[model samples]
Target: MDSAVDGLVSQAARGLHLRVAQLISEVEQRLRCEVPALWEYPDARTSEYIAEHIGTILNGLEDGTRLGAIDPPAPEPGRTGQLAQYGIPVGAVLRAFRLGQGVILDRMLEEIPRRTNDPELVGAAARKLIEGANAYVDRISERGVVAFQEERDRRMQRRLSMVQEAGVRIGTTLDITRTAQELADLAAEYFADIVTVDLLDSELRRDGAPAEDPLLLRRVARRSVSEEPSASVAPQQLHTYPKGARPYRALITGQPSLHLLDMPDEPVRGSIPESEAGALRVHSMLVVPLSARGATLGVAQFFRCGASLQFNDDDLLLAQEIAARAAVAVDNARRYTHARATALALQRSLLPRRVPPQSAVDVACRYLPAGARSGVGGDWYDVIPLSGARVALVVGDVVGHGIRAAATMGRLRTAVRTLADIDLPPDELLTRLDDVVLRLSAEASIDTDGEAVEDAGTEGDIGATCLYAVYDPISHRCTLARAGHVLPSVVTRDGTVDLLDLPAGPPLGLGGLPFEAAEVELPEGSLLALYTDGLLEARDHDIDAGVARLRDALARPAASLDATCETVLDAMLPERPDDDVALLLARTRALGARQVATWDLNAEPAAVAGARSNVSEQLSIWGLEEFGFTAELVVSELVTNAIRYGRPPIRLRLIHDRTLMCEVSDASSTTPHQRRARVFEEGGRGLLLVAQLTRHWGTRHARRGKTVWAELGESVAFPQLALALPGWDSG
Candidate 1:
């Protein structure tokens, strides 16, 4: 090129640089007309890019160097990459560059003819400017295309990775709220700036079908990338969207819908709160239905905020795919929650409503079910009032969870109460309960014809662990036995806490295993704690640590038994326990010598009259003159029976407690039978008459002898004689 042509090109380049702002404006206008997609960007942003392009061209012309020889601007590739991320097509970007190039070429060629009158020089400058402009446009266009493709591939990979992560992260637990939270967190981290998961209220509660017309939704989870809390709905909040709302429409149609909040036609004020709408005015939102197995479970909302790219068709599709995966998890959690709720209801119903009133101990108990993932397990505690003013404190835990475990627990509890009614020792009662469990396991395994069914070995095998303790206030002793259960703890009156030393028998359902009982004489006001293994194995499964913590908790002085129970739970249990726990705490009470009277009588018929006289004298002394006649009659019959059929060393004892009790014991293991008196026989009516006179009558066998006992109702005697009787008042 000639120096004159070069000088001309240089002059035009300087002139174009001087008018850069005007050039940018003209190029932007042309781009708006030719490449409408560029119009989506703000005017200032479009002008900034156009200014960079014009600057680069002018500098190359001033230096008189080839435009292709210089690298593009530092931000050129990134600018095009951003356009790709914003979902702009490469063709549209290349067209915008071409339009700006034409505008520059026209301005420079027009400036050449005005500056130089020579035809040769003007023609030479025009040709040079056109050549340089075309080279620059081609160079940047190639770079833009490469950048756009790379960005598109990178975004596609990210989306694919997010979908794969959703499979691993969501539905990790059988908890509806937790699953929803997992979905929201995953989406907010990768897919959107803000995400929310809302399910039908019925779906959350696992009740009824999804509502369509007026969608009743509960926000189960909400997540946002911003530090500031969203002005939208909160988690666990229940709200309803009207029929025409975007969320309602998506749920009704079972499809995803995208809304540009900045668009005038997409009014969001009526669909959402004004604050939320205002907050989202400059963003785009995607509402995707969480549908699984042909059922619409819920809806997920994704919001692009600040400078983030607006959601487009591909984004909506991705949101739908992610929501589809999450929907299956949510549905599974909903179904599992329904089953867990049913099992929990059954377990609670089968448990004791309230501890029965008894004078042996002041008791308080607590039962906690396992975490949602584990389902509801079988854990039960009962305070059964046995004969002789004694009470049984029992806690049992079945091996598995759900309805079967709960049912088995109920059956075992019933069996314990029945065995207790017979006044069996703790060891003997557990032995009987073990037999009951074995029978139950056997029955569960067999089919209708009494033949064993396939796959009935482990699934149908019933197993449990129980701790049964019988506390007698009269003797101030507690006899406790266990079938593979944690040892019971005792807090002595001196504030020392220790676990009782007892044999750890095999778990129930293991036939032929002998259970042993340990008898500990508890002082008045001593605390006894009976609990299942769950209480000791919940945290790290370190039973020693749990026992130490429990011992320390029990050692603390509490105002009441209920407070002690709370303290023990707070100390021994984690925020969420992994297993079922049943705790029973009892404070011992003693019946003083003044409340009981005993006599040793020989095995003679004459001892019956003396027994009757002695009972009358004791009743008068205890201010129970009102019950003299009934007591005398019951004592007469029991003593006569013991004298006739029993061995030597017969004994009679009377107890003044909640009820008046008379017991006659002899060195005979034979039990008496209550038979009807025929018209021909006069000898069978003594036991029958004794049963008719007392409120309750039964016989309990001991190792050395059998005791026949009867209890008189206190309704007629206690209230009238409470003030007159010394040391006979009910505590």
Candidate 2:
């Protein structure tokens, strides 16, 4: 080699070294820190572009350099080969280089070409280039590693703060959406962007839509991160998205759908957003799919650039951690919502509708459900209209509580309506009801789990206490019967009184016990109180005490019947609302402000005509019209029964209260019972048909022989309509 050529080569090499040194210094200045060992741009872009930038900085530095021959700064600072600082992150600063796999290809392109250069320098230079490239890569990788570690530290700290905040802000589990939002805000703060969480589904909610499931709102809350995320739903705006009906693209597809869109630069929509904000404008972005169990809550998207660059992987990972925290919060909210809706539905289902508007009588009623919850029980009341211008009042209870209890209540309601359609008196209706109860009991041990009492007496013993009564406008007679139900309280213009009908029979479904309807003349302007046991059963008082309290409240002056009932219940059953209660107040006022008379009698057939005349006279005296026809029919049935099956000197008595009552005295101790009328038999049909025609008729023993009686309801509107000729004085 010539001296001149060697000198020229040496000088050229020195100049190149000086240029690289100046370039490195310029890059460090631009980065606002040391370039951290060696650095290179991704290779997908022209290496020429990188060289150009490097050359520009280098030439400018060289133009101002005092030493053009100095060896380039010892081939980048030499300390530990890889980055060791935990606080500074590697990926944080080098994030853009990795996006879309640019960094991967960059490393490949940068190494292969340089390693392949030359024959004389082949092995030695190849090894040297490889080692040098490794060193450079190590430095670049260290920066990213530092950045990632720093991000991890920040995320952990944020999570700890969020947990502490959750403990302070929402101490317990209550309210849906409220605590969720609070936790959501905390998540947003932790990740410093849009953080969302959607919880999983459990037994109640099969899907995400509120309409698809009654209990779907339960189990929506924050979940831990150790669990894999599921598809979730999140409204882009305020409109809460239920979830995806098809194959969800997010972390979840069921209720509370969401995804972990943690990185600010990583648009959940997949593209580097091409909106007003450019894709590359991102400083950092994070995304995490919030999920729990198998449910996919929703996605959480975070954004991080003020005026800088795309978000890094560390940021995205942090967003995911934040979403995990939100999952727990959402669960609480959904559970609270489910509980509240269930309570409301149960209460509404067990109440009666508004009172029907009518002229025969003004009716108004109200039912206030017990505030406490014990599963769900059934207690119901009804005002059923019957044939022949009559109305029936009934109230009953099923024995258990909760959803099952409510279902039983529905069944009982259907049964009561069916019985009402037949228009049977309380007793006969009860007999049929017993059959129904027997059938139901045979099917299962527990009736319907609420107020539907379990039939424990035997196979045919399904039981419920009820009070059935009929009211007639013409007679102003309220015929009421008690089936092991509470005695009713009557408030008269004269004073308050307990109209305890002694003929009350056993509850329905109990050994087929019979029921007897008891009649009382509701003198004009009378108030009758009918109520369920819940009204009479309280924490501190027995049913008897409750009844007494009701009576006392009714006695108070200057109070309407409905008002009195309400007041009494309010005063007595105000606290500890654990039982079901129902109350119906009927005010039967004879519009005419009329007067009437009543009498007693003994069973006797010989007194038939006289009893009829007595009843007729009584009706005339009371200013009631056209009683002769009804009187004849009433006497015939009463006298016939007395003579054929009754015994003794019969005394006849008449009643002018509402119906024309014909009574006969007799010595016969056996009370009359009605058998099904036969087509061939002549006599049994008499009493049977008689009992069916009138609202009510019965026998009661006093001092002497028992009395057989019949009541012929006065048809006030059509007085001339016979429908029946003079009975020829009947039997």
Candidate 3:
């Protein structure tokens, strides 16, 4: 601390300034080669400038200037900004300056032996050199430290801004996979060279508890900063983490982990997948648990690979913040997924498992709900078998979506079947359905949310649209009526498509309006496509365009009704339909003359005897001798009743398809009801005998009057009729 000694040291430093500068320059040049930031500067001029700055500092030391006043300039004008731009940490800059000091001292030590053989001069000169180097290094480092702190503060501000942006950007939608991927993408953009997001199985399970094992985590999202093509696809997503893996450990501990791969002291080797571990040459990794509400839902891993800086405490904090926000979004999505699954199951249970087989129509159907945004809706189709080889093909749509709409759709379907069984015409059936809907809308309090509508007539209406059509193989005609439903497309036998010219009646539930029915003569082998409005109405196209698209798809019929149904859906339904779609396609097949037998009977009791004889003969010829006795008995009883209590113009007909159909028509409009006759009753037992002798029998009132029909199964093995066939069949 002697002033004279300091002055002597300063003079020696000035005289030796050039030697010190040369020695320091040599050391700096070597160190810059290893330091990333220094290597980025313009070639030899950078070294020369550094050397001159050192010489100026040595001259200041000789002149006895204060350490603060003597500034060692040389890292160019904006060293702080330059180092930061090159991603060089302030520590690296300070290390380079420290290396220059060692070189100056080492050069002075070598000069001590050559300066003189006198010990005093050698010792004094060496002390001055060491003191000067220490003072200069101390002063310059202070400046570097200040600059470094400033640069670090700026970086911290920028990272905070990025974190705020990520909060707003990530999990913007309630989708589990998307939100996870967003976290990975954001991390890869700013903090990491590679990112992966793995979620716990419990967070994805419908029960909200892990299936089989709760500790298993499934990788849901992954990303890499490099765009280089790799031989292997990224396994960051859709891969499982072992129970004891690093990600799993992070989840269990609910803590962030930082591992520097190059450090032997860090104990995280063999922690990740082998392939991923091998890919890390000079990398640092940080793993943080995506935890929320005290539950660890998943973990996020960020890797700084290649030349990127190692993972530090600040980086870990940012990653944990991102993972925290992402965890909440993922949890929300998981809950929504469970709700969606429940809704889908309800919809499936309400939908028909398979279309009922009909003798008149070969049917195929398809129903698809709208995308995730809409969840499940009330689009439905059904094939109900009407009496006499006629089938009612129906497609309906409820006004709303989700479980409520589906429940409403099921109710409407049941109502249609109930009305259809009564043998009402298509138009009349819809009229009654509208009444049912109006009542449903009024009684809306019942919340018939999940009742499988066995009797829709009793339930209140949810708003809906329906297109009901009845196809008769005998007449080769289909009678269709609509209530605010889309028109159907009919593909003729010649493969020509035409939209059915039917009136668009008001949708169901809106009462006071009458629905009209239109009949089209479908030729044999013709195709009939009935669909709900969802098929013909979408955001991209109006009903007209949709019909046109459908017409084009069905222009040339496919090989089978199933194929045609698929083709129509593939063409008419958009990739992501905006609404639920229900389609029903049927191919018409007429009953040939060989399949039907008809007869006209006189309006007299004696005519019954002749009708029985004719039915017996036809059954024998058609190889239905097993049912000949039953047929004769049915014909006798039907004819006698038509003649005894009915008007004139009586007729009998028999259809042999899957079953034997015996129909008797008369001019009387009275409907026959089956009643339990007293043990002594004779005449009332006629209808009762017909009912017991056949599988089913019903009376349908026609335009002219009425037709009482009975259908018997193929095999009738019971004893002969006890009534002896109304005194006509002694044969």
Residue 257 Cα positional deviation in candidate 2, in Å, after optimal superposition: 9.9
lDDT (C-alpha, whole model) for all candidates: 0.83, 0.52, 0.76
lDDT of 3 by residue, 140-164 (tens): 7777677777777787797788779
- TM-score ranking, high to low: 1, 3, 2
Candidate 2: C-alpha lDDT: 0.52
lDDT of 2 by residue, 47-117 (tens): 33234434442343334331122222231212111221212344434432222123222332343334334
- 338, model 2: CA deviation in Å? 9.1
Show where candidate 2 strays beyond 4 Å.
Answer: 1-150, 153-365, 370-376, 381-399, 410-442, 446-596, 647-682, 688-731
Error of 2 at 383 (Å): 7.6
Candidates in order, TM-scores: namely: 0.79, 0.50, 0.75
Point to the candidate with the largest lDDT: 1
Candidate 1 residues 246-287, lDDT tens each? Answer: 888888888789886666224543324455545545378898
Candidate 3, after superposition: displacement of residue 599 in Å?
2.8
Question: By TM-score, how accurate is candidate 3?
Answer: 0.75
Candidates by lDDT, descending order: 1, 3, 2
